[model samples]
Target chain A: MNPISSYLSSSIGRKWIVALTGLGLFGFVVGHMIGNLQVFIGPEPLNRYGHFLQGLGELLWVVRLGLLAMLVAHVVFTIKLRLENRAARGTPYAVTTRRAATLPARMMALSGLMVLCFIVFHLLHFTAQKIDPSFLALHDDKGRHDVYRMMILGFQSKAASGFYVVAVGLLAMHLNHGIGSLFQTLGLNSAKVRPLWEKGGVAFSWLIFLGYASIPVAVLTGVLK
Target chain B: MNLHLKVWRQKDAKSAGKLADIEARNIPEDASFLEMLDIVNDDLTGKGEEPIAFDHDCREGICGTCSLSINGVPHGPSETTTCQLYMRKFKDGETIHVEPFRAKTFPVVRDLIVDRSAFDRIQQAGGFITARTGSAQDANCLPVPKVAADAAMEAAACIGCGACVAACPNASAMLFVGAKVSHLALLPQGQAERTSRALKMVRTMDEEGFGNCSNYLECEAVCPADIPASVIARLNREYTVAAVKDGVA
Candidate 1:
């Protein structure tokens, strides 16, 4: 109890909480992108993929519950730390020149909030199929869930696709700062390897953006249909 | 060198502060930044006016007492303390905006002088070793690796300057705490209270109203001592390990 109290009360402890949970979400994001890329393999494989996920049965729910917990903790601790950071600066400088904080680093909390909203919207649109009830019961020719058709139809709408692209773009910026910062938070950042981690983070974020954006772009151009 | 200076002016902590424009003429290029200020103060005093108040001690950069944020850069544009900054660094007609180190924990005692005793409180929290002084240990008896010794010395080089807080967007004292933590944690003498040291110092830092480190790295860039941000990473690592150890214990 003493340890828990001290740990929770410390700022560095909160940072560790944010970094560890962020790592979990980052892994899920990568796994999800790869699974969605299966759409390029055609309806049978993609539908089978979705079916295989459901095949996990109760384990799938456990993972979902775990991710939800992680998301809640990450968001809560982040906001708390952000508020503390703001209060720490009692007076703002009359003139400011950026010496260290990059644009992406400065926008981290804002982008994080937007990404949170996007995650909820995405789950409603795709996972629950509640956003568009028309896609809820559709099946492919193989009698499997027509996830492929739903994706095509979902992206066919210019507004939805536009919203998705913007959301993913914000997600990319979030990752651009979050990834390199994780190394710092974990104390793995060394002077020798810091630049590699920083550049690698930007590269990884752009990669995720290109992968996520490819789906909507393909569907909108009638390539996926 | 003739320079236009906008220096922050305040009578006391309760009073409001403003930047006062004053012209400095015929300053020697070899004169230090503080010396130039001295000349200006002398002229004001001669004219029966109150001289601008600022902090100073050793003209040498060793003492962390001298502090000024020159033109938005802490300790001026040079990679040294304000006392060590030379007049030659500025153009003849250039205008310099000088302000005190700003942070919630550090309140202004007057113009260009903030009460940095928050640092003393943080240091007192756990920045020392409590070894018995029965007898001096032979240097050969305690075998420290060269790399570890060098790193410890680098961390120990911190002069307790508040520039890191002034330079930080969040006004975090992580770099200062990081330096002290690494300095102690690296040495065998500092092993007795390593776990508790990390916990107490961090808790005190938070209580003192300092911000959490966000990896901005501005502190390292503006640091006159050049204490690297990697030290801060080490602080995070040490704190994490300590917390986990305490949790299991």
Candidate 2:
């Protein structure tokens, strides 16, 4: 038991927590992107899809609560690890040189912070409908919440759409370094596949950026409406 | 060649230190970095001033005792140990900034020398294996696979140098620990204690206050032995399996 506690507190242990939570969040992001892309399918299908999710009553809340728990754990463990990391370097070097580390690798904490803020604003904007209470009352011809219309209206404003694009861009950057790092942390990497995983991570992250940004771009271009 | 040297000058571990500008004149182009320091110390002794305190042994690349960070690199411009770095690598009159490795765990004992006993402690924790106390086993008695032997040899190449820690942005010792863990775990002799070794070593490593590996790979860049970052991945695997087993049993 003592060894287990110490093991969990170790650097590798914190990495497991951070890496697993990051993977779970990545799953949610991909799933959310696919679901939202349904907006391009037309209003009725999108609204019905939204209604079906709301219909799952307890299961939807369960998923929401699970996401929340994972988010908190991710944030808390990351902060703890970050503080330890900062403290480990007692003093700064007189001359700093970076030879092997990439910009994305060095900027994980910074990018993670930006993405977390975006998540907060995102929930306020869409899930709670706090940004525009009027969207809450919009019902389709079938009396279902017109989510497709809500999305179009949401992105019609240049500022909101622009902000969404930038936030997701930051998320993509985070994943640019994170997904490859996740493989290493989970002991899934070896010499032969390391380069492949790293390149794949970069490519996948950009794909997500395009997938997410396409909607806002479509809305602003008058294609999704 | 002449050069402007901004070297750290700490009296001792408890005192704050700053860079002292010392001019190195007529230094030989072929002189190793440590020899240059020797010439400077000799001149300082002639002037009745305190000589700079730095660590070195064997005056060759194999020993890991030299611990100066030259121009913000662990071992100067070369991909080798500081002792092997020569004066020719720098231009005439280059202002070389020399500082000690600045990890909190490897605190500055004096100018250009930090206490690396932290590494020794880590080594003692589990960087070893249990075997029968007897004469040397026959060479072919234990037939290790060529790949395993090569990997083990690679891990064993680490000289317990703290450069990995110094170069890491997080001051992590994962590269060093990874090397040690991988070195032993790859062999048949290390099988008996593999489980406890991973757990105990990691526990000790954490208690020593080294930071997490963020996969920056700076450690690999600065490692004199050229230990790859894959060792860290191997360490993660070893520790995960051990911890899972430990939790249930």
Candidate 3:
């Protein structure tokens, strides 16, 4: 086999790809949460922010496509690894106990799958405006797409926002393990750095959870009119 | 102290098996786990019943030959080999589960013995240096730094135990491969084959049906040799460098 392809397909190399793409995805989600938190600053700033992204035009599409590619690689390789993991364990132990593996570490692929489902729903609800068609028609007094009020109106239904929070929760759980694992996979985790990254992973996961969920919570609680 | 035992009873590789409940009566607290098993086997032999077959050698924990999953934890709830485990860890009447290591690479050879030749095959891939087999070479000939020497010694402490494999959720052999590769890659004597050693061993590890490391650290927790998870990181680094060189060349 060609060395490059062989390396890319090797079990260790595959993890590097997963980690790199996960890093990319992690960046996007953190940025997404920060941008969405503009809801706290009130409507005009939030809508203007949305319009700014839209104003990026073709460059926005480039970013979107790039993220899509990363997501595809992340999901495809993760599922492939998960299946292979199952096959490698010929038989389940009659009894097993967790010694050092954290809850997030064990729930990695499963949580990722759940987060994927939420991503699809989120895109439909906000990005494509499929879940709530009225979101497409909503406009501010300035006639820009009213992303701020759209969010407020979109989050009017408790169920949608609840699922959003739940999805973010699952995403945070996924991040809890993934953030630390990427360091190890990329050979960046030194013995001293390992514990730091593990704790950092937890801190970052909670930040993600609070950052994203705050918007939905504020909307549902009528803090955002 | 008497105890209940759930021993995996398999006649052979081709046969199915289940945990057979056997009463380990009159066991002494000071008896090593294997001794307790010997006592149980003696009882079975005296009664003309088939005794539970387990793998053990050196009774002292130096040999990685004793493979048992006592109560789901590899080598029991201790950071030592099965031979080092004693009855004192258990309470009277507590049921202990003894079974072979489970992995696609390590197949069950008998009752409590899995075919660990998979580890041997991985070792044979690139686990050694090509140093001249003779009396100790002049220590002054090749100078090894203390940091490298210590790391190599730590990695070399691996007894080729499959506890890492047994404990890994994905049944990964990365820890074992990592230790072997790290040990050789750290020394000047091992420099000649370092690049190829990493490439071949990891390739063989994957081809042998070992799963990818998810960095769960379970292997490090259960490792009798105390092989740090950092060796796995080293393996990843070494392979990346070697693979890149191979690709570029």
Candidate 4:
């Protein structure tokens, strides 16, 4: 392996990967949020958007594969970095607090892992369509899987809606740190632009969380049906 | 004023360390932090107990020798070095907890004394100017910009203190190594060996088993010399460019 590649494989390399893949995931979240906002336009438009995505077919699969690769790289790098940090520090002092980190930056890895689990459950509940065959069986007049109806029915249970709300909350947290971190990694952040980036990250994260969570919340409340 | 001290005590490099509580009364509040420790050691010696061994010299704070992790913060709550800290910072009757710099690469030699010679070894690996002796050149032979000179001076201000490592969550010495590398590599006199210098220093830094930087910024927060973490960023860029240029990447 090349020395720089080997260096990247080292602990520092892991950080670079986290920063890079984190930027990729942040872009994905923004795009996903925008697409999801169509739900506010009612089922017809939302369903059309879902169908368009489904129509991508092989391209969609490529995108999914790319995302999976990014996720695996992110998680693997995180675990490696965490283990290396622990080994180097030996034992920590008793007092640990959030003072060392900004609110969202501190729980980034934890929130990211939580969001990862939620994503898995989300795919099973909707994408994989295997967890609930009855939901998968529903179809619209256009012979499309009634993704809108599935989403509505899926959130009918308070437990399911509540889980989604928390998941979105965690996703927001992950985005808060990740968005700003991407700029830092790219060497774009400076004293002049850093505060702007920080505030912009917070705004972007909240927008994404609200956009995604609104679908579940609206459906559960019978406002979308 | 009276003070309660909890000092970490270890017999040797391999020994398990513990906090040994001791009481010292009527200490002057104006004493430097190390002077307070000195008083405690004097009391211990008077009692026929072995005085706690800690590293300190040139109590004015330039030497970077007085290493202590006070109350979970490296060199106490102040941004200054341990030797520069004053006894007045603590309240009367307050308990002061002191420990050596904790990291895998910094093994404890005794109470509040760790062998930081690993840092010296790493520095020795690739941290000097290669300019040949007595090769006299005119001062005006090489005209360098003032901004570059200032940047180099700022980077050169690093005193080789392990505070960057001590304050870092992963105990990364990149800030220290980067400063050293940047100081020399930025100069017109040092550009001839920049690629080789960065590669050799970075490899030596890793070989010394220092952890990677996570960019927590704690090193900047606690650095007595106030060396910026930006130097580490410059170091990363230099390393990448050098590695590529050298066909090592």
Candidate 5:
């Protein structure tokens, strides 16, 4: 085997790949969550932010492609790792207990898959305007693409709002375990600050969850309209 | 005290195993978990029935030979080995389930015994220091910092028990491999082969069909030696550095 293959095939190599890609996606979420909060500052700022992003043209596509690549690498490696992990335990335990494993930790794959579904549905709903015809038609008085109205209207429905809330909750749970684990997987954790990293993961995950969820929640509750 | 056990019974590795229920009457409270099995085996033998087979040695929690998944937890509910588990931990007439360490790489030798030579093979790959025969160096010649020495000693505490493997959802041996790697990598004497040691041991561990760590931390909780999971992080650091260096080479 070549040196690269040998290295990547090892467990540590796979973890490094997972951690790096996960950190990238993590950074994207933090930025995206904060950016989405622009809805509260009124439609002018939020729509202008959208217009500014659209003005970037080709640069926007490049960033999107990069994020897409990171997402693919993260998901593919996770699946590969999970398959190998499943194969390691050929026999299932008759009576198993979740003694040390937390709910989010154990539900990583499930929540991850849920988040994936949400992402797809989300893009279709907002970006492509395929899921909802109204999402494509709405515009502000300034003759600009009213992203702020699109978001508020998109989440005004009970079903869409509920789905967004549930998906974001799952995302939060995934981040809770994934963020803290990134340190360990990357070998950044030490005895001195292990607790800080672990606890910090929970706090950060919840922060992202509440931040993202608040937008749809505000629209549904008529706070953002 | 009277106890009931639902012990796993398998004819061989290729065959299926089932839980064989057995009754232990008048068991003393102080009897260790292994002793209770022994008494049960004796009764089975006297009755002209096949005795239950389980692995045990040193019975003192040091050999890492004894393995049992008692009541759904590896090494029972205690943070100690199965041999160290006593009847007093269970209430009278409590029903317990005993099963061998089940991992794809660790096939059951019999009922409760599993072939754990994979660990020996991993250790053999690079878990030691190799030096030429010469005059012994002075103890103070290579001074290791107290923190480094303590960290190395902590990693060295693993008893090679398969509990970490058994407890892991993916049955990953990262903790075991991590402990083995960190123990040597921390010491000044182990510096000569540090890079190669990390690379070789990790390859061997992967080849042994062990799973990847998913950060569940179950190994730390169920470990008989209470080996922390941070050693895994150190092992990750060591392996990455080695792999990157080797790739460059």
Candidate 6:
């Protein structure tokens, strides 16, 4: 606990954790995005892919457990760093009314929390096969539960699709800062490279949001059934 | 060029401060910002009024002595120190609002003179390399990559100016503490005492009543040395590592 405490308190230690956990989560997002793109491949292929993933059974659980650990570690480290920063500042500095904090810096924490909440709800709605009975009843011609069909059915409700859209939008905002910050924390940012990194982060975030959100929107609009 | 100045005037720490407007009629537009102040002081002297007393030395922007919140910016609109700011940057007949560095730890002594001794105390707590001086060892004795050495030198360039504190909305000395920690922690010469040094310096920085860094980045922007905010990140990493090592022991 003391070692963990010191790690929590140290500057570089926090960054190392952030970088490692961030990279892990980034990899997960890439894989998740690719798997999700199956939705656009049409229902048959996507449902088959989902069943195949479900067939992995114990191996899939191992992968999921590993991802859960990584996510938990990332969240814990982030909250610890934030709290430490607050404690270090004994009093607030004064500023004139004309000079306000920039929008991105001010909203980073809020956006991050929103993304966290969204992830939980997302897992409940789509992954855990709970909360929605219609998703549980979804089956393919082969008599296997079709996760892809359930995803489409879930998004058919305007309220659910709207919520997913908003969540994905906020996730983009979180990634906008988080991605650039990950490079900076790892000591990879420089004057020459920062602008490129910033642009890359923006591009990556938009791509993820657009790709992830499109499925739900398409299903809700009847572009997919 | 003539300019109107509104400067904060306070008799003592306990007294409520006020903005005292004074006319600074000058003939030279090319004068440096402080030089313009000198002219104003001379005018006040001629009128049998007390001259505005502000902290300044070296005028070369090397020393971190000159501190003032010009208009709303820490060193005026320039990305440099107040001493490096020239009157040529300002327009004639413009009204400049000058005030002392406003932070709880930095109380005004008189006029623009703030007691920045808190920074000094934090530095004294651990900001030095404890390595004993010896015969000049071959620079090759320690193989430091070029990148690490460059980062260390950049951190070492901090002049202990309280500008970072003044510019920060939280008055956090994360930049200063980060700079001090990184300067030593990154170098082979400073590695032996890295853990202890970080612990002592950070404790002192916190004890001095400086605010935490919320990543506002104003400290980096206002810093005359242009020290990067990455140093703070490095400091955070070092501190965490040290704490972990200490815990294991």
Worst-scoring 10-residue span by lDDT in model 3 chain B: B129-138
Scoring each candidate complex against the real one, what DockQ results? 0.73, 0.75, 0.81, 0.41, 0.81, 0.23
lDDT of 4 by residue, B1-249 (tens): 889988888899787878898887778999878888889889889999999899998888788888888887888877788988888999999988888888888888888888888778767777876777886899899887998898889888888779778777788888898788888877898788788878778777777778866666777778888787677767776776776688742
Candidate 6 lDDT tens digits, B1-249? 888999988787778778899999964877777888899999999999999988899889898888888987877777778888888888889988888887777888888888989888877888887765877778888999998889889999898878788777667788898899899888888888888888778777766766655566778888889898878767766776666566666
lDDT for each residue of candidate 2 in B78-148, tens digit (9 for 90 to 100): 98999989999999989999999989999999899899998889889888987779799798888999999
Best by DockQ: 5
Candidate 5 ranges with C-alpha deviation above 4 Å: none
Model 1 whole-model lDDT (C-alpha atoms): 0.91
For every model shown, what is its TM-score relative to the native structure? 0.96, 0.97, 0.97, 0.92, 0.98, 0.79
What is the Cα-based lDDT of residue A121 in candidate 3?
91
> What does the interface RMSD come to for each candidate?
1.1, 1.2, 0.8, 2.8, 1.0, 4.4
Cα RMSDs, all models = 1.6, 1.3, 1.3, 2.4, 1.2, 4.3
Superposition TM-score, candidate 6 onto the true structure: 0.79
Interface RMSD of candidate 4, in Å, is 2.8
Please, what are the lDDT tens digits per residue for candidate 2 over residues A1-225? 486676677789888998999999999999999889888888877888899999999999999999999889899998999899999988889986878899989888888899889998889988899999998998888888989888999999999999999999989999999999999999888788999889999999999999999999999998888
What local lDDT score does residue A31 receive in model 2, on the 0 to 100 scale?
94
Off by over 4 Å in 2: A1-4
| Fnat for each predicted structure, in order | 0.69, 0.78, 0.75, 0.25, 0.77, 0.28
User: Candidate 6, what DockQ?
Assistant: 0.23
Model 6 Cα lDDT, one tens digit per residue, A52-144: 888999999999998889888888877776665565433333335224355655677787788789888888888775768567888888887
lDDT, candidate 3, B50-115, per-residue tens = 888888889887878888998999999867998998889899999888888989888898899889
lDDT at B4, model 1: 93
What pairs collide in candidate 5? none
Model 2 CA lDDT for position B65: 86
